[model samples]
Structures are given as C-alpha cells and as structure tokens.
Target chain A: MSLREACECISDGDVLAIGGLTIHRKPMSMLHELIRLGRRGLSLLVFGGGPDVDLLIASGMVGSLDAAYVGFEILGFAPNFRSAVERGEIKFTEHTEYSIMAGLQANLLNAEFIPSRLLLGTDVLKSLGYKTFKSPLTGEALVAYPRITPDVALLHVQRCDEYGNAKVDGVLAIDLLLAKSSRRVILTSEKIVSAGEVAGSPFEVNLPSTFVDMVVESPLGAHPTSCYPYYTYDLWHMISYLEYCRRGMVNDYLRKYVAGVESFESYLDLVGEDALSRIMI
Target chain B: MAPWTTDELMIVCMAREVENGDIMAQGLTTPMAIIAYYLAKATHAPEASIMQLAGNIMVYFDEPPQASILYNEYRAMEHAVHIFGQNEVYETIFKRADSIVEFFRPGQIDKFGNTNNSTVKAGRTVRLPGGFGIPDASPLYKKTLIYCPRHERRVFVERVDHVGGLGLNLGGATSGGREIRIISELGVFRVDGRSGGMRLMSLHPGVDVEDVLSNTGFELSIPENIPETPPPTSVDLRLIREKIDPLNIRRLEFLSGDDRLEALQKILDEELRIWRSSNVNRPKAQQML
Candidate 1:
C-alpha cells in the first residue's frame, strides 16, 4: 500500500499507537503523511516519546496524550508538548513506562487489567485512577493497569516483505506490543523483500505477517530518528528542531520539510544527500 | 594527575554499588550509568552483565566501548552476547528482580526518595520528561541508585510535585530489597526503609554539612559524626579517563545550556573521526536482516 492510502484508513479521533523508543526507529514518513492528511482529535499512545510526538502535538491534531515520556534527552524538554500542556491546550494523562507495557500485556492476554506491584505509593494511582485490587489467589494488594487497545498502530522498520513479515535492526522497543495490541497495524519500511527471502531467514522475522494489516515500502522512512546500522539519528536536524520549537516556528519547519514537499523523496532532497550521508553508518 | 571532577567521583561511587555477577540495566541517554556499569564490569564485577535497555542487547565486554550519543547502541550491538526483544527486557528485570541494580537520574526527588521525572508543580505547571520505567522497576530492583548531577533545593524537595517512582518502602511482598541511595554533587544520602526518611550518608570532600543542609528542601537525619565520602582512587581515575570513557562523555549529565551543546559537538566530532576511520559501510545486505 502507498503511504497516503495507508494514512487514509485512519479517521479523526482514532486512538493511534506510535512505534519505537525515543529518538529511534519512529515512523516519520507516516507521521508526515498524517500531518498532510490533516487528521485531528488523535489520542496518541506511546511508551516512550521524542520529536515525533512533539511534532504531532505541534500540528494541533492531538486531542489527548497517554504516554510515559516525551523529551529530547540531554537537549531539553520537548518544547511543543511541554508548552501545550503548560497552557492547558491538551489533556495529558501520564503513565509510567511499565504501566504502558503492562496495559498492552493485559490487552494481549484479553484481560481487563493486569495486576502489578508498581504504582503503589506513587502519585500515578491517584492521578490516573488505577485501582488497587487484592489478588484473589494470594490476597495481596496490586495495582491494576488497564488494558490499552489502540485503533491503529504506525511503525517503521529496516525491512519488510510484501506478505507483511518485517524485521527490525537494533531495538524493537514496544513496537511489537503496539502491533499486537492495536486493531489495525500500518508499517513503513526502508526496503521491501520477497517472501522467499524473508522465509529463508525466518528466524530474523521479529514481526509476523499475521499481525500486519498494511505495509508501505518507503526508504528513509525513519529520517531524523535512527534506523540503526543503516543510519544514526540526525543530531543536527534534532538541534534545529529544538530551536524551531523553542522559537515557535513549527509551521515553518512543517512547510520546509514535511507539508511543503510533494513526497518523502522530496523531503529527503530538502534534507540533502550530504546531510543524510553523514548519519549513515 | 589532575583533580577529579565531581562527575568522575560520582561515577566511582555508583560503580561501587554493583557487586560481582550483578545485572545492571542501562536506560536511554544515561552516559554516566553506562560508564559506571562498564567500570564495574571491567574492574571488580567482571562477571557483571549489562542489559542495554535502549538497544535491547545484553553484554559483558572485556573492555567498554566509547560512549557516544549516536553510536552508543550500534557499538554495543557489535559486541552483543544475547540479542533479545523489548518484552524480554522487562521480563528479564522481573525474573531477576533480586539480582538487578538500576540507576536513575530523577528530575525531582523527595525526602522519602519518591522521584518525579513526570510533570512538575503537582503534574500541572512545568512538564518534565515522564518517568520511563523508574516507578515500576524501582520497587522491584535489588537496589536503586539515583545520581543528581547538580544538587540544589529544586531537585532535593521536601515532597516531589509528583511521584513517578516509589522511594524507600519496597511496597508489596515482592522479592526485591529495600535500598535507595542518592548521590548528588553535595553528598550521598540513603533513605531509611523503616522511617521512609532521607538520612545523610556521607558528605563529599571539600563540602561542608551546612552546604548540604541548606541545599536540601527537607530536614536531613544526620548522625553524630559524619565522615567524608572517599575520593576516587588513582586506579579508578585511570580506568575512567584512559580506558572506559576517554572522550569524557559521562560529563554530559552535569552540563547544561550552551556549554552542553558545545561539549556534545566536541564528543560527536571525536566519535565521527574514530567511526569513519574504522567502519567500512558494508554493502546493503541482500536479505535485509
């Protein structure tokens, strides 16, 4: 499927689960397409966040965020998301990274909530309304992290087969859970291979075809963030992104790199081959 | 040798926390924790295993790799002993809760050692990077060590604005131990499991007790006689400077503003020079795995 066509499946107010850890293999191409499509009222579900979540928040499409983190690491706070929350622009429900994972684990098990020892004595219980239930088996009190089932999950990987079997280099993060827990899964990849090739090395296939709904082959799909081995994160671009967000020029960034371009190739052209080459490992 | 910086001193303190055959989980953007684990594995805890949370690779390298923002994971993966998925990372932590010791750099920590890497101002005013796995895992770890690069009233609060991680009380009937030690520029503090209060462990050299008291937002439990925190030995200094982290990337945690950016660029430049000289871009593999 094409990027635009895959994005068209998403509707406004959809619960969207974003794949990848902070500053790693985020689905940048799909996010750009979603921006171009102008989808709004999105409830973003992510375990770890970075510029992608900030950019989506800046796009004014996000209605609420259920996340563990959203930051630029050593650089500073994620400007757009931080300012938006500070100004009461968006409803943000924070969860610890474990809660996010546990929620997904519950969903995978078809359970209402998973009992956990975490979140006890922490303010997350009062803030998020996670109830403390006594386990029937042991009579021990445990925090019940509710299941998280997103409407759609967007992921980017190093490679995928047309049959929807995919492989990722480096960290998988929560992408696998996002794929399994979400109702619909849309994948973007740097390369598309034949089924025979993928089957020959079946052990390498981390994501099976059964879970994938659509696969779009888009090279440089994880630009700015890393796809590892293939390329490292473009730190210079991130530095510029932080500056643009700090100066409240996100629209200009969108124009120059995302919406201004006709396609992903054009976006890459604007980023320049030399710039991309510098990040390639 | 030159006088050791506080960052190096803290790294040595943190490294001392890890025992032999321990599993230290390294989280994202933690250059100091990364080096501390490497230092431990290279020195006393040669059997210590490092679980890279960001890269999802388990390793026990003979020598630590250079710490770079861009290449930390890639370089770690090169020496991968066991490559696993994200779910396994959590499962490993849970299964080995009694043997794991993790380090965190909380945005705000309170008297009871409750941390807040989430939003500040009672989760309303200033937004901080949400606590990744600290809250959940801290309760289950054998020991939780928090290192604050700059110690001040802002960080050492009477009560944190939000509780992203539980402190001294290892809640529930988990097999994990009750141990939370905090190291700051001023000194070291340990939270009492019974009272759930912060107590002065030791003051770093050249730092007065008054300095620590004034900087802390809450009243600290001080003993009758307080000894100075031992300075880094010459061997520890040598290992950190000459072997484990020659680029001094661990200092990044202590830096902020323009100074941080400048330091980061210098490290990146040095990394790029080394990377370019050694790595030959293998032709894109046909199988794509």
Candidate 2:
C-alpha cells in the first residue's frame, strides 16, 4: 500500500507510539507522511528518543510527547524539544526506559496496569501520573502504570511478507512490545517478500500478521537512521541536521527537505545518491 | 614529580571499584565510567564484560574507543554482534539478569545519592534528558555507582527534586534505597551506617576535607581514618594516557577542556568514517528471522 493511504488510518487526535532506539529503526517514512499531512495535536509515546522525535516536535505536530531520553547522543542537545518545552509549546514529561516499557507491557498482559517497583519513590511516578497502592497480600507498596494502548503504533521493520509477517533485525530494543501493545500496528518495511519466504525463517517472527493493520513497502525508510542489516546511521547527515537545529532553523530544514519534497521518494532524492550510498554497511 | 589530570584521577579511582567478572553497563553520556569500565577489563578484570546502550556494541578496548563511544561508529560494526530484534535485552540484560554494574553521571544528585536528570527547577521545568536505566531494573543489579564531573553545592543538594535514580533512601529491595557508592572528581563517598546517608570515604588530591564539607549541602561523616584518594600509579597513568586513549577524548569530561576535545573528536570521527568506508568491508547486520 502507498504511505499516503496508510496514513489515512491515523487521524489528527490519534496518540502515536513510535518504535526505535536512539538513531535506530524508527518509522520515519510514515512519520514524515503524518507531518506532511499536517496532522495536529498528536499525543506521543516513545521508548528511546532520537532525530525522529526532534523532527516531529519541530514540525509542531506534537501536542504532548512522552519519552525517556530525547537528546541526540553526542550530537549535543535536542534544540527543538528543549526550546519548545521552554516556550511551552509542548507538554513534556519524562519516563525512564523501563517505566515506559511497563506502560506498554500492561496492554499485552491484559491487565489494567503493570505493577513495578521502579517508579516508586521516584518523581517519575508523580510527574507521569502513575498510581501506587499497597499490595493487600504483602502490604508492600506497588507502583501501577496505567496501560497506554496507543491509538496507533508506527514501526519500521527489516522485512515483511505480503501476509504481514514481519521481522526486525537488530536489538528488539522494545520494538516487540511496541508492536504488540498498541491498538493498531502500521508497519513500513525495507523489503517485502512472499509469505513463503516470511514463513521459511527459523527465527521467531516478532510481529505477526494478526497484529498488523497495514504494510507499506518503503525502502530506505529509516534514512539518516540505522536499519540494522540494511545500513549504518548516517553520521554526516545527523551532524548537519543538528547544526541546522542549533541555528534554530529546523523549519528551514523541513522546508528544504521534509516539507519541500513532494513525497518520501523525493526526500530520498534530495538526500542525494552519494549520501545514501555512503551510509550502507 | 608528576601530576595527573582530574580526568585521569577520576578514571583511576573508578577503575578500582570494578572487581573481576563483574558485568558492566554504561551509556554514551557517561564517558568517565566508560573509560573505567574498559580500563578494568584491559588491566585487571579480564573476565569482566561491558554492555553498550541498545545492546549495539559489546566490545573490550585495549585503548580508549574514541570514535566508537563518542560518535557511536565503531567502523568495526560487522565484528560486533547485533542484538536487535532479540527480545533478550529486557528479558536477560535487564529483568532476569544477574548482578551487573550500572554507571551514570546524573545532572542533579542529592546527599542520599538520589539522582535527578529530569528537571532543573521544579517550577520552570527545564527538562533534562530523563534517567536512562537502573530505574527499569534497579534491584537486579548488584551495584549502582555514580560518577559526576562537577562537585558543586547545587549538584550535591539536600535532596534531589526529582528522583529519576535511586540512592540510600530509595534503592533497597523493599522499594527503599540501598547503599550506593559515588565516585566524583573531588572524592569517593559511600552510604554511611550511622545515618543511612552518604559520607565521604576518601578525598582526592587538591580536594581538601573542608572543600568537600563546604560544597556539600548536608553534613558529611568524617570517618575516623579518612585517607587521601589513591592517586593513579605511574603505570596505570601511562596506560590511560599513552596506550588506552590515543585521541584523549576523555578530557571532554571536564567543562573547561570540553569544547576543543569534542571538536577534535568530531574531526577524527569524520576522517575515520572516510577511511573506514573506503578500506574495510563493513559487515551487514545479521537478519535473524
């Protein structure tokens, strides 16, 4: 299916849960589509933070972003996120990676909330609006994170078949949980194989066809970000992108590439052939 | 007479804490702890291993991995086992894992060693990056050690405003804090038995006992026989300066020394990228079904 068609499932008020580690396999193609479509007031839940979050916030798409660490590693601060938080443009709340994991885990566990000891005594509970109750059996304090079943989950996978059986190559890095927990799962794949090829693998299929609502073949989808087995993260692009952010011209970048380009293919073209070829591992 | 840079001194003190066969984990932000984690493995604790964030690269360094740690580009990516898509991280590395060492350099740390990397002011809410790990699986780890470069009153506060990480007050198994060790540029501190709070274990060179006392917001325990921090032996200094860290990216740990060091790292990293892509046959990430 086309990315534009896939984006139809997402509405303006939909809460999105993005899958990726820092600079890793994020659903950039669909996120760009969402931004391009000018979807507003998105409440987001993400595990690890990266350029994708920065892009979303800079585009004024995020109403409230719930995440753990949102800064670019070694590339300095997340200028758009920090400035927006300071300007009161986005309501920012912090979650430790584990607590966010617990929030997602609750959905798959078929429970009201996931009980964990991690957030207790930490302001993460109070700030993120978690509840704590005494365990009647042991009389021990337990922190309960409300099950956050996102309106939609956008995931980028290494490969998937026509039947929607998907495989993610690298650190499951909470990608599996993100896939399973959300209400609707949208997958963008670098390669689309036959169901025979998908079913032919010996490894566990982390994201099954049952959970997937849409599969869009978007090659080089996680540009400037690493898609394990496909390419390494584009350090040059990331560095240049941060320089633009530092200048407070994230919008300028969006205009030139993200907003300016007619589509994902055009954006990749603007990224240029040399830049794309260089990052491949 | 030879002297050690504060970075060298802190690294040495931190290295002493790692015992043999201890599994260690430190992210990109904690460069000081990263060096110590590598130094211990290279010098004394050969049996020990380390885990990078996202489980991307698990490697031992005979020398400081300047590009690998700083730019997140090891160039040796193929040799590194990619653990992505494997549900083993949360299952084995975090929750069900055995004893491991968690290293952090928190933005705001209180007297009890509780850490806050969430917000600077409770009202303005200047959001720092949230706490990364340990909060997820704090109990499963054997030891939680802190390494902060700055030793100021604001950092060592009466109490942290937001407890993103646990300390003497909240890290215990009962969902309360257990004893934690803190290694900083100024000195070493451990949870004291008397008050269940942090106390000065030893003072580093050029850092007086009064300097620590004055900087700390809470009263610190003056142990009966407080010893001066053990300076890095000449041999270890040679290894760290000459052998281990060729690029000297470790200097970026200090504020005054950071800008230039980081610039050099970026340049070296760019150059390495060019060289690596041209010469090496970079391995693709294994696609495990």
Candidate 3:
C-alpha cells in the first residue's frame, strides 16, 4: 500500500491506537498526516502514553482517550491535556496507569476482560463506570476492564517488506500485542526492503506479514520524532512543545503546526532540517 | 509505633492544634487524621479551610472526597482542571500552603523529605507509582510535617532511598530558617538546627519513651517533660467518618501492587467498623460517618 492508502485507512470515530511513548519511536509524521487530513472524533488509545496522545488531544481531534499516563515525564506535565480538561473541552475516562496496558493485554489474549488491582481505593475506575465485583470463593473484589480492541493499530517500524512483515528492534511487547489485537494494522517504516532482509532473524521480526494490513515506506517516517535504533528522539522539538505548553499556547500550537500544515512533508518543512538534524545528533 | 485507632483521643489532639485559615497537608496512613484534623478545624477552628489535591472543598457536613462529586461540582463545570498533572490545582495549593504536612513511608522518602514514588532502584526492579511534584512542593512551604503510622527504626532512618522531593533545605539557602517537624504515632520530632539530627518533641499519650527510642534508627535528642497527645473526642470522630470518609479523598493509602479489590474492601471494612463501634449509642457520629 502507498502512503496515501495507509493515511486514508483511518475513518471517523475509529479508535486509533498509536505506538511509542513521548518522543520515542512514535509515528509522528503519520500522526501529522492524519491530522492534516482532518481526522475528527477519533478516540485514541495509547499504551504507555505520552506526546502522541497529547498532540491528538490538543488538535481537538480526540473525542475520548484511554491510557495509563499522558504527560511529558520529568520535563513537567501534559499542558494540552491539562488545559483541555480544565476548559471542559475534553471528556476523559481515566484508568489506573497500568489498567490501560492490561486492557490491551486482555485483547491480545482474546479474553473478554482483564481483572486489575490498580484502580481500587482511587475513584478512577468508578468514574469510568467500571463495576467492582467480589469473587465468591476468594472474597476479593475484582475490577474488570474490558478488552481494548482498536479499529486500527498504527506504528512506525525500523524495517518492513512489501507484504508488511515488519521488525522493530526495541520494545517489542506492547506493539506486538497491539498488532495482534487490532482489526487492521498500518505500518510506517524508515526503509522498505524484501522479506529476505527480515527472514534471517525470526526473533527480531516484531510483526508478521499476515497481521499487517498496509505498509508505507516512510523514511524519516518518525521524523520530528524517533523510531529508536534508526534514529534518536527529537528532544529539541519536545522541549520546545513543553515550553509552549508552559506558556499555555498549545491551542495556537495546534492551529499553526498541527491543523495548518497541508501534508506530513509540509509538517516536516515546518520542523525544518536543523530541527530534524538534532535527533541525529 | 502501633497504628493509632481513629478513637476519641487522637481526634482531640488533632482538633486543638489545627486552626481555621491554616493550610494542612498530610501523607499516607493519616488520611483519617488529615480528615479529622480538617473536621476539628471546621467545628472548633470554624474559620479553618480545607483544600484537597482532588479539587474539592471540605464543607463541614458533606460526604468524603469523591472524584465523581468533585467532577460534578467543580471539575465537570470547570472542564479545565488536570487532576494528575504538574501545575494542576494541587501544585497551585502546594505553592501557597503555609504549613505543608506530608506522610512518608521510609522506603519512599529521603533525608531532606524528598520522596521516591518510583521503583526502588532505577531501571532494575518494580516500577513504584510515579512521584507527583512532591519534591518541588516539600521545600517551599513555611512548615513541613512528616507523619508515619509505623515508628520502626527503618522508617526513622538517617536517609531515604531517593529524594522524590526536596524539602526546605534545613541549612541551605532555601531553608529561610524554617524547620521541618516529623510526627508519628509514637512521638513528634524536629530536625535539630545545629546537627540536622532528629530530636524528640512530644509523644502520644500512653506511649513509652523506650518504645520511641527502640523504634527510631537514628540518635534523637529527648526533650524534658514531653507532652502527651490529647485523644480524639466523640464529636471529632463523628465528623471524620460521616464527612471525610465518604469523599474518598485519600491518595497513596494502598501500595501500588496491592490487589485493588482487597484494598478497597479493607477501606469498606474499616468504615463499617468505625460506624458500628462509634455510632450506635452516639447518633451524631453516625450522621457524620
């Protein structure tokens, strides 16, 4: 599939699950592409959350979000998420930071739901309308989080073949689970190679060809971000976003950078070579 | 020190001290105490105000802090408040509090009252709950209080695993000469200005000096004629159960790894026990609980 086909696969109201946390190995260019195409009311479910979710929420495209943690770590908080919640613009169904991951795990296992001990004592689960039931034999109260099966699983991979058999060298578990659980999988890769390149290392092939629905050869695909092994994270942009969030100019940020850009390439132009080069540094 | 029961005795001690208009902060295991402290302020210290990190104002006779209640009243309408992020409502209050009181489990708190809400060793073992901006908040307050239910030697140790937060530097430029107070079920202690060592302040009623000595890991200076903490009253207990418990405002009570079901059940059981024991004969406590 071409880049345009992969971009068009996302429709309205679809739960778009993205890979990576913060700036690490996220499909940012594709995300910007989806935003440029004006994808609205997409409920995003980010596992091990970060800026990808923040950018979506900030763009006013996200209707609902399910994740464990959704803030910029150490640098400060997620200002866009915070401001949105503060303004009552966004509606959130918060789960304990871990339960969000557990829900995805249950989806991979093909289970109906997963029981979690993370939401007890806090009002997070109850606020989400998750019921608590006591096990008859053990007398332990159980919090049942329904399986998270996304409409589409979008990820950026280090390498992939024409058929979409992909390999990600770092952090394989959650992305692999997402690939297995979602109905459709869209991959954006730094390089497109033959199956021969990936066949020698069965252990390193993160996503099998059968599971992939489409593949887009997106070199610098995780540009303005990082796909790990292939590139280091674009921290300068991340730090700039953090500073922008601190100033509470995130809405303006979305309008100018996220919404204003015509395409992912244009978005890359907005980031420019100097900023992108920092990731390499 | 043994866990202090939410009986009449502890309530009275907390009530007399917590005055109106005073910003009170507390840590884990003392959610009830923090609640009781606020209740006493409301009834006795009528001018006292209560602000919670969860974004609720503790009105005198209302339910405990529930996110749903807060969501409906303030969060829902405001729609802009980020509950868990830095620079949220909690950070605003944390910056403004005159007296900031926090509870510390030894494993999580460092020498300067810096807390570690992370896994013990970085990148090695279990990931503990991520730390809030406690380190930034700890050192900024006029007064910092550390409360503990367990008065073990390990808890009262010389240093903590990591400084999740940095308290007012006792001897540093930030100190501004403000001293930190450590309160436990066994006794209350303060950092000695000269040595930075823990020194005895007062003990809870019926607590022994030897027990305090035995449990503390570091050497402490004993003050002569240590005062006993007054017990909670019937009225104080009434306000706590009825008003505070129902809100469910307590954060950090259960360990991150504890079964959610069991932890919640234990909370329910404790609430029931408090109600059954204190409210039958005394109807007012029932109204409050």
Candidate number achieving the greatest lDDT relative to the actual structure: 1
Output per-candidate TM-scores for chain A, rounded to 2 decimals: 0.97, 0.96, 0.89
Which residue pairs come into collision in candidate 1? none
The candidate 3 chain A region of ten consecutive residues with least summed lDDT is A117-126
Per-residue CA lDDT of model 3 for A133-238, tens digit only, reads 7766687777777787899998888788888887664333256767777889999888888887767778756578888888888777775455544445554567
RMSD (Å) per prediction:
2.1, 3.5, 23.6
Q: Which segments of model 3 are wrong by more than 4 Å?
A: A116-118, A246-248, B1-289
Candidate 3 residue lDDT tens string, B124-151 = 4433333333433444555655555556
Cα error, candidate 2, residue A127 (Å): 1.7
Off by over 4 Å in 2: B1-4, B54-90, B93-98, B122-124, B138-142, B170-177, B193-196, B210-217, B233-244, B255-274, B283-289
Docking class of 1: medium
Best by TM-score: 1
**For candidate 2, what's the RMSD?**
3.5
Ranking by DockQ: 1, 2, 3
Error of 1 at A178 (Å): 1.3
> What is each predicted model's overall lDDT from 0 to 1?
0.84, 0.74, 0.57
Instruction: Return whichever of 1 and 2 wins on DockQ.
Output: 1
Which is better, 2 or 3, measured by TM-score? 2
* Cα lDDT of model 2 by residue, A1-281, tens digit: 99999998899878899888768777889988988899999998887778889999999899998888887665556778888887888988778777777777788879888776666766777788777788878887888777878989998998889877887765456777777888888999998888887665747466788888889999889987887767767767887787788677778999998888889999999889988867665
In model 1, the Cα lDDT at residue A228 comes to 68
